[model samples]
Target chain A: MTGSEVKKLFYMENKKGVLGKLKDGLLKTRRNLTERIEGVFGGRIDAQALEDMEEILITSDLGVKASKEIIGIIERTDPVNLRETLKGEIFNILKKGEASLLTNGHKPAVIMVVGVNGNGKTTTIGKLAKRFKDEGKEVLLVAGDTFRAAAIEQLSVWGERVGVKVVKHKSGADPGAVVFDAIQSEKAKGADVVIVDTAGRLHTKAPLMEELKKIKRVMDKELPGAPHEVLLVIDASTGQNAIEQARIFHEAIGVTGIVLTKLDGTAKGGIIIAIIRELEIPVKMIGIGEKIDDLRDFNAEEFTEALFE
Target chain B: MFEGLTNKLEGIFRKLRGRGILKEEDVLSALKEIRLALLEADVNFKVVKDFVERIKGRAIGQEILQSLTPGQQVIKVVHEELTSLMGESYKKTHLSPNPPTVLMLVGLQGSGKTTTAGKLANLFKKEGRQPLLVAADTQRPAAIEQLSLLSSQIGVNFYGTKDGDNPIRVCEDATHKAKREGFEPVIIDTAGRLHIDDALMDELKMVREKILPHEILLVADAMTGQDAVNIAQRFDEALNLTGIILTKMDGDARGGAAISMMAVTGKPIKLIGVGEKLDLLEPFHPNRMASRILGMGDVLSIIEKAEASIEKEEALRLEKKLGTDSFTLEDFRGQLKQMKKMGPLSQILDLIPGLGKFRSEINIDDRELIKVEAIIDSMTKKERGNYAIINGNRRKRIALGSGTMVTDVNRVLKQFIQVKKMMKAFSRRPMGGKGGLNIAREVMKWQ
Candidate 1:
């Protein structure tokens, strides 16, 4: 699509109720103020123009801290080129804290997917396995979610489609034992990466969480530093609640990075900005569609621009 | 918002509320309520099973039973477990140190991708960042136009050619433009298909390769319920998503999507769209959200909104008056005005913990509020401060002047008297200490 066409897509009117209305209002106000400021300045920066810009920023839902920092930079910078300078300052703040995707230099980087039930943990692992397999890496799937009968079968189905080997036990088996076996099998087969899928349980369930922790411990013991990446999968559709989910998972088991799934669904994608603003955790990847290749590495600047667009 | 769950919980808790200790059966009954609520909310069945088991384990423990207030202790346990079930800490998005950090927007058709892109850009623009918008969704009719319009609306720079082109190419070019133009953040809006189609996957892969975005955000609609979780799984498998944004939370959705989606998909929900407006977006907070879902009003959030809307000194002054039972109709009008400032009455009502169940029953229509305001407007300044002066004749006159019926005015007066009496009794109650006055003070300060 042409850049203009892409921009048009980004600007589509959100029909959903209050959220849509709020977004439209903020954008409209910002646009009007920006135009007014630009008209007044005529490409020249002035103190009044700076103040107007600050109001615009504050109105755009940028938190007070970030807005103040931006304003501070604009106040301190050369007035003649204030707008660009302010933009540059805000960009710097957004770019400050970012985490990279999992890359352990091992023959097969072991990424053990962790998350509660219905957070798309199993499917994400399946997709990750497929992505690695498509990249010509020897990938193995281990169904550690022994609690659910369908979960193991689900991973097995994905494993077959992705042309990867899946290791699983019967229903009601030990998840830790399953991971241990999968790792041993992968090592024996000289696999490039081993992706383990564990049972989905609430982070609140201490015993279940303990079980997951135990599984991680066993995986590490079997293959030292084996579960190199504990990618916490979260559903993007949960809106602000996703932040809470991230917190619980991180506390129960250290989450190295996050895999945000289902971005293609809601206008609340702006929550990512809030997450970054509040938690400062780096998002490793995002899922936009239900395809093996939909998982892509996260880019904050691109995300910010797409959101505004 | 959480009225359904809260009502179920309250019914179960009512039996245990007055009791000093909660027996195993009492905990079991509450768990049953939780179980039903979870199921109704479309939480994954397996997750619910494990959750109930965990809660049961803690509830049956000797420590809880031996507590001074076992019922409250059990409730606290449930609340804490629920909060933990979500997540304990806020996870921030990972921003790259490099300039032109790419963020890709992805979602299924009708998922509000374009709108979310605009909201995100506006968010960054508020941060004073020069964000470049990339229209990468080429297949959908008017997709690029939609994005362009949003970018202009948000006053952000748009990057994309007019000619029909591949989305990946547009992203590549947009990245180049962002770099050349010195834009620090670049947002790419990608195409989405009805289901997980191969063509769409290939296009997303191409775009990912071209842009190598710093963050890949998946936008999902909360109204889709369990399907949202499945869709998220598919997307995560394909794109290795970095974060998630749930849209359309302002609707009548039971918020099952929020719970089930999170349980099924491990991606952190970065933001929530409470309304369609650019400013309606808010950062996800688990504790507040848990309380919201439990049918417990988020007092802190309510206070924050109130603080934002009203002067702190005025709020404090009003609080003091409420404490002494000196709150008058003038204060009532002020409170009404404050409620108006917060949002629509119905919307505010939804935020009340247990009141959600009666939302439909209690028609807090704006028209009714307007009628009340009109009646209050007709009152003399003296009568407003001292409602005792509002005699029957004056009530009829005020009703006529306000364009409301005498019955409506009488109803308002009666309700007012009840409120006054309740406030007086509340102030005199010895327990009206810190906790007792909290709800009453909040209600009085609503304006």
Candidate 2:
């Protein structure tokens, strides 16, 4: 068949897989928050009922501020359309902050991924490399997280799996030098996109935060206006600390967007609303599973719909 | 990023203290703040609700109403209740009387099970117990290598099957080897899936049945809020865990999971992994954790009691605190409070009238001491010394500042004069007689 027909066929198969993973990853969140709200609707909408709904939402890792805001909307609106009112309000928060990766137009668009340890910085890089490669781009993986012992090897494993080239140094080498080398390699090979993975360092660690700044400076020196997107990967299960982490990292390095990972592992995926409302940073992707295909470009409507379904 | 939960709770109580009496409304308002603080710290909502309710029940009762320091009494109740909620006492992992105690570490992916397994092996090795690291987590990419690397770093014996061996078979074979090799603690690090699936659970169940580990320790990431509690509960339902090992204590987690995990799962947290280092493992203590959460500063009283019972090196540290000029107003406040807790002074004085020679060593009643503290608290650093410089105007300002009358300030000044005279006399006591030597030795007991 022709190119457009092949693209349509792939989209047909990929869309089904994407929705399936979304539903699976958000199943616990739906059961814990949305389903509980559905049960509340079967009764009178009173102060007690509204408090119960508020508890469910807040306990789902949605901060007290956002949960109360939604509860206020539910209480003020007509009771007959409570679910729509709540969903619409949540959709508004996420819809306004919607963003996608800026990998187009720029040559070898550099994206820097940063977050605290175990928030899946390395794994998400692996998935991003795979996705960009699947889109027929020349992708080069840069192992910029030189602090962690297995981080280099971890990204290299993904590089091998996705059939992409991973530029790395020794475990304790300066991460800026590694990024410099990767950018040099990308220039020589005329790569389409370069995704860099930084070590999983806490925002509280000043030296590590300084290291991230140095790496960004090195990227700019090599290719001015490089690192087009600085993505912060946050674990879905993290509570209010996720906001603090995002705020500090954004202040330190000006994070462009977020990648919420380990969605399937938590019932508190409601932290998504908290992050969006508090940070105003767009969530570019959601990690639904451990597999490469589990990471999907975020759709605000699909995410809100999956919560109810 | 991480401060004492007690500081926030105490901020609420500081407001209540201004009210003079503990009313039900005051208790309710303070409980509301406590609930939010606990929730923000990632404590389970159910646990936070129950914890606040319990504190409110005790706080609004006659105990707080009748107590002289009602606000402090409420805080004490919170500290006590928090300690009980997190498991009343410290619990050590039970070692089997028989040799080769097998421990199977299981959790979701990225929960630090493999790293904790290495830490546990290193700890047992430091205790002079032989430990074998069993690499049964053959699923995740490089999981086996990660565990083996940790083993080599700590120089512990490791057991692993060749490529493509089922985890259950690997665990079984590893245990067999551990027993034959005389390893006292066999740590079986099992595989973890990104999410809990029946396939993964069934495989873990198979490993559990085959190995029949003496202790099934759940290694959970402490930063996971309510999910850690749910994971602990689910794992407990499946594996019947012996204890929990909370990893990433070094991180700036609100510590909600560490507080709620034991309550939700009804399992003790045997150990905590503070950092990536193998030697950063610490035994979990509920009382000290409660004190730290309340901003009570690690509850040094627990260490003091431990020193009293064990007579360890920590007693020397306490002695230094007492013997040095580092004893400031803050230390005096603590000492005054501790002296009131020591009981009636008349009986002690009747037993030993010679206590007057060693006045600093004596535990005197502090009911009159609180007023002295208020007066001293109002004094500027310069005025705390050179009492002669405190003229009439300064005395009036000091009285107004401390909310005491000028007459009360004068009475405190007069008491300080008498105490100074007595201190001069006691300082001149000769160190030759048996009584003097006995007094010096009695002072050393507390020092």
lDDT of each: 0.66, 0.74
Fill in the DockQ of model 1: 0.03
Per-residue alpha-carbon lDDT of candidate 1 for residues B1-447, written as tens digits (9 for 90 to 100): 445566666666667778986788878878987876665554544566678998899989997889888877777777777777766545675657888899998877556677777888887888888888888776544457667777887899987654357777778888888888898688888775634456667678777776788888887766453345556777777878887787766544456556655666677777877664566666677777777776577666655565555655665565567645467888777666766666555555666655645554654445566788899998998888888888889989999999988888887777667666665665565432232224334443333
Clashing pairs in 2: A145-A199, B6-B294, B319-B447
Q: After superposition, how far is residue A129 of candidate 1 from its true place, in Å?
A: 43
**Weakest 10 consecutive residues of candidate 2 chain B by summed lDDT:** B431-440
TM-score of each model, in listed order: 0.50, 0.78
Best by lDDT: 2
Candidate 2 Cα outliers beyond 4 Å, as residue runs: A1-17, A186-188, B1-4, B162-164, B299-447
Interface RMSD per candidate: 16.3, 8.9
Q: Please, what are the lDDT tens digits per residue for candidate 1 over residues A1-309?
A: 354654354334335443333333234323444565465446556666665664455333242345556677777777777655754554554564356756558866788888644556765776687667767888888888776434676677678757888888986799888887877773525888888888766453456677878998997887787678888887654434455556767777788877777554432233344456666766787765454555666665644433333
